[model samples]
Each structure stands twice: as structure tokens, then as C-alpha cells.
Target: MSVNVIILNGVSSSGKTTLAKAIQKYSHEIWLHVAMDSFIAMLPDGREFDREWFPMVEVSREGEVLPQMTNGPSGEALLLEMRRLVRGLSETGFNVIVDEVAEADTIADYRGRLGNGCLVVKVDAPLSELERRERERGDRLIGLAREQSERVHNGISYDLEVDTHAQTPDALARLILERIAA
Candidate 1:
């Protein structure tokens, strides 16, 4: 049987991963969470040291702030790699939940590569709520908020759109399940 691929896409701190995990926990579907952040984090030393992927961040150590590496690879490259993984997983009969900031073009490209059975869900929240979540998540976004807003408007349309600002994970998961069933 072919897997039901779901792309839980949204701006940063939109709770994509949280909701994706909830669906995986509640549903009987054989699913995999292909997190871009974890993918970037696991690169080998040679690739990890490359300036193109691993950028330096000024991190706090005691009273001092020092540079550290964060956000490996450009967003485009990361999304492409994620599409490749999704295609592989779907071919192997595993439903894939991709929690990434995939652009409209990337989504279109991936849809072609993964075939028509894929479901794209756009998880969104109020900008203010998203900002608070971002702060709470401890991912120093810097200028990403502005970029996220712009991309959300421009990104490809989704099969489902959920405003997760006030709903619990279970509620959101139910919404997703209902859509998938429909």
C-alpha cells in the first residue's frame, strides 16, 4: 500500500513538529518525522565544519558570550534534502510528516517527485502568538519572523490549514485526522 505523506508546513514556531508528533502518536499510520533541524544537526565532522552549512552563533557561556554553529545549510538545500527523504520513505510504505518551512516552489517540486497522494497541511497561528512561542522555544530567530510572514503569504496552498494558536495538541490532531479521513 502507498503511504499517506503529510507535509506539516508553516512558519517558524508555528507548532508544526508538535502537531506532527501528536498525529504520529494518535494515528495508527506508520509515520516518520523527518525534522530538518535534527537532520542538519547530525552531519559528519567534515560537512559540519563547512561554513556554508554551519554558521556561527554568539552563545552565552557563564558571563561571556561566544560564537557557536547553528542552522546548518541554506533553507533551500535543507528542504530539497527533506523532499528526497520523503520520496524515499513514501516509496518504502512509510507515511512521512515533514515539519519544515517549505516554500511554494519547493512544495510543488516535491509534489511532483512524491506523486499525488501527498497531503500538505499548513499550520498557522497569530503572529503575536507565534512570536511568543518562538521565544519560549529558545530558538533565537533574529530576522526570521519577518521572513516567515512573507513566506506564509507566498507559500503554496495546503489541503488543510489549522490555526493552532489556542487549540491543544489533541484538538489539532483530531482536526488533522478528520481531514485525512475525508
Candidate 2:
């Protein structure tokens, strides 16, 4: 049997990781979870503010301040490489679940690069719920959900849209499995 790829896209704290973990735990196939956060974490710290490296800027919207990470040249290259790595893994017969924030261009890139056999899933939660989750998590920068919620799914379409606020991760994973099985 050929390997399959599932791309879980959503804003910060929207439960993509949770759903990915649930899928890995419940699915008979051993799915490798490739998270953007883990790849980003691999980058050296203290460069997030450097324009030539990974520049993150603070922007205010509706009286709330948010940190927006700019995909500068370096960041863009890293993202492309990450996408390629995921594709390569899948080509090598490894099932892959990619958890990422779906920026418009990034979605397009994945669509073009991965082509068929890729199931794009939108893991969603209301902006208010996302903000609450972000706060509760406390590991993320303040207002990241707000910033990402505004832009992450722009111009992206999905085979499945799961609402984390309404569904538990395990339930969502089952739904995803059913969809893939059909």
C-alpha cells in the first residue's frame, strides 16, 4: 500500500497538534507527525527579530497587540525545505501528518508541490475560543492567535474541516480516519 499524507492547517492553539497526536495514537498505521513548531524550534533563538533571519513584528488590531512572524527569505527557504522533506518522507512510504499554520502562500505552495494524495484538513476553532486556548496554553506569545486567526486560512480549501471547540481531538481523529477510509 502507498503512504498517505494529511496536512492539518490552522491558527495557533487551534488544536492541530492535539488532533495529529490523536490520529497517530488511534490509527493502525504509524503516522509521523511533522509539526512546523518543531521545525521552527530547531532554528537558533535570538534571530526572530533580525530582518535577515526571522523577523517578527508587533502589530495592533482592534486595540490588541499581536506578534506577526514575517517569512523573510531565510524563513521562506526553511519552509520550502520543510515541505520538501515532508513530501520526500511520503514518497519513501512513510505516512505523514503535517501540522502547520496555513498561510495563503504556503497553502498554495503545498498544493503545487505535493499535488495528489494529499488530504488538506482545516482544524478550526472560533477566534474567541482560539484566544482562550492560547491564553490557557501560556507557551505562545500573547495575541498570536488573534493575529493568526485573521490570516491563516485565507485562500485555502480543505477536504475536512474540524472544529476543535465543538469536537474532542479523539473524535476529530476518528472523523478524519473515516473520511480517509471512504
Candidate 3:
């Protein structure tokens, strides 16, 4: 038997994870939250100190704060595995929800990897709201969301787009479910 897959792409603290959880809770079928954060957490101990993906921040000419992401061999390999995991799980009839912080190039890669069967949702919040959530969460880089906001959704054709600040996660999940049904 086949199952559904949902890829929720968004910046940090934009509520992708929250929405993913809500989707899982409301869905009749069991869903695995296979997220980028889970892959990131698998990196070796020193990675967070010296080998982190976004090691630092840079300010753009327009003064937008941005996180600089660098992927060495290890990071790249983990990402490859993450994509494979998503494909493998869904193919084996497990419903999956993936939350990611993906840019245009990354989204393109996913488009090819996930094929037409996956529902790609663009999750976002206002910059102010994103920053607020980031601060409240207290785990992410201070300006990562602001920097990611500049280009995260650029040039991708999404199946659905939801604003976390505009509605509760349950409402957004229902909207996403509706979109999937359509």
C-alpha cells in the first residue's frame, strides 16, 4: 500500500515543526516526522563546535542579517542520507512529514528526489514574528530566520503556502490536509 508524504519547507522558528506535529496528530494515519533537525542532531559532537552547518552570520549590503551555511563532506553526506530516508520511508508505505530549512537550490534537489507524489508546502511567518519565535525558542542563531527569510521561498512552485502567524497550527494543518485532498 502507498501513503502520503508532506515536506514542509521553512526557515527556523517559522513553525514548520509545529505544523508537522499538528498534521500528525490530526491525521488518521500514523506519520513520521522526518526532519532536517533530526539529521543535524546526528552529527558528531565536535561538529556543533567546529563543523556546524551555519557556523556564523553575515550582514548583507542592505543590512539584512543572514546565516552563512557551509557544507563540508560530512554535512553533504548527511543531507544525501536525509533525502534517501524520506524516499525510502514513503516507498515502504510510511506516511512522512519533513520539515526543512531549504533554499531554492535545495528545493530543486527535493523536487527531483521526491517526485510528484509528495506535497511540498511553503511554511512561513512574518519576519518580525519569525524573529520573535526564534528568541522565544532560545536554541537557534539570533538572526538565522531573518537571513533565511530573504530567499527561502524564492523561485519554487509550492503546492501550498501557510503563514504561521496568521493562524493556529491546527487550522493550518486542516488547510494543508484540504490541499492534499484537492
The candidate that achieves the highest TM-score relative to the unseen native structure: 2
Please list all clashing residue pairs in model 2, or write none if there are none.
Answer: none
Best by lDDT: 2
User: Model 1, residue 110: displacement in angstroms?
Assistant: 1.5
Per-prediction TM-score, please? Answer: 0.78, 0.93, 0.90
- The reply for model 1, stretches above 4 Å from the true place, is 1-3, 44-51, 54-78, 153-155
- Mind giving the per-residue lDDT tens digits that candidate 2 earns over 30-82? 99999988877877786654786568889988887789977778777887899
List model 1 lDDT by residue over 1-182, tens digit each.
Answer: 23378888787778888998899888977678888667666777557546667565565545655444444456347657778878987887777888876677777887898776688888888878887876787854643543465555484877778888878877998888777777
What lDDT would each prediction earn against the true structure?
A: 0.73, 0.85, 0.81
Looking at model 3, the pairs that clash are none
RMSD of each: 6.1, 1.7, 2.1
Clashes of each: 2, 0, 0
TM-score ranking of the models: 2, 3, 1
The list of candidate 3 runs beyond 4 A from truth reads 1-3, 49-54
Candidate 3 achieves a global lDDT of 0.81
Model 2 ranges off by over 4 Å: 1-3
Better of 2 and 3 by lDDT: 2
RMSD of 1: 6.1
